[model samples]
Target: MENAENLLHKGVIEGEEGALNQFYYGYEANDPPEKQLSPPLKSKITGISLKRGQRVRLETPGGGGFGKSSERPLEKLNYDLEQGYVTETKDD
Candidate 1:
């Protein structure tokens, strides 16, 4: 994906503050093997060696919100509340 600037706001806290890179996309296959799973940073990858009551699944995709977190930038929402990422509800 190579959008190393924490593109698409990877776990944003001011986009992880001056972030250099924090990509997330992963793989490995077969609960029944029809062979398909590859995205992000995959150029020539082919490695699947699992057996022994095999069962594997690791799918993750949800990190792209650029607005409406109260429309950010109160100094990045006080640095996401002093780096606890975010908290203070009770309709904060």
Candidate 2:
């Protein structure tokens, strides 16, 4: 048990993605015979959790190596106006 923890700690510290994956397998493989883990947690740990789509708008333009057009929805509208273009703004 301690050996497994040590291995997992090392893997995480070293950013070894594959080794971290193996650690999860090892965890279930070594689960005690009398105890059972719930399915949802296992699924989440394995990255199978339910996902919902989200719309993300960038918030700044031409900063940190971004293009002038790379601005948030509202910010982009402002940019367009500043650039002498017409754009419709969404209301929500």
Candidate 3:
């Protein structure tokens, strides 16, 4: 991904004041065969659509958060392409 800007630090504040796009390699869950679903759906019946080089965003809640200004990688992400709801992952 290009143009990634880190927007926060560890319990302080740093960088630009806005959202940051984080990129990762993973597969999106695909829909089932012959099953009708939303065109932008990320998950199918029992599998996820295989993909790579996807991006997600992270931001502070209520327009404020604890962190310093620095470049910190995303801890974990399972973000939805459509809803923008990020789920934390247990992987590093």
Candidate 4:
């Protein structure tokens, strides 16, 4: 579905080495699913199969803001940019 977390085992399959059969990555923020009325839905995945000799790269989805993005402090937002947590256009 839309906005779903990405795959954890997204990497190149290289020489003879076994990859992880299971995926354990971070998740997006628990924002309300619709209309900002109900609580966030639970996010989970059953399992995944990996091939041998696969190079694995693990990454977690960054969570969204709890409230309006504008409500976030400029200092913190700038910090995020400085630390490469996120990027924004000059206009933003």
Ranking by lDDT: 1, 4, 3, 2
Clashing pairs in 2: 58-72
Task: Provide the overall lDDT of each model, using Cα atoms, as 2-decimal numbers.
Answer: 0.46, 0.32, 0.34, 0.42
Per-residue lDDT of 1-92 in model 3, one digit per residue for the tens?
22323432223355333334332223234533333222332222234353464322233322333454224444322223235543334233
RMSD, model 1, all Cα superposed?
Answer: 11.4
What tens digits encode model 4's per-residue C-alpha lDDT throughout 1-92?
Answer: 43334323322233122122233323224533332222222354444444453333343453333444455699998998899865686332
**Per-residue lDDT of 1-92 in model 1, one digit per residue for the tens?**
54443344344534322223322222233333444333343323356555555444543334544445666778988888899666666241
Mark the regions of model 1 whose C-alpha exceeds 4 Å error after superposition.
Answer: 1-44, 68-92
Winning candidate number (lDDT): 1
Worst 10 residues of 4 by lDDT: 11-20
The estimated TM-scores of all candidates read 0.26, 0.16, 0.19, 0.33
Determine which window of 10 residues in candidate 1 has minimal summed lDDT. 16-25
Tens digit of lDDT per residue, candidate 2, span 34-60? 443233222124443322442212111
In model 4, the number of clashes is: 2
Residue 73, candidate 4: C-alpha displacement in angstroms: 1.6
Indicate the TM-score of model 4. 0.33
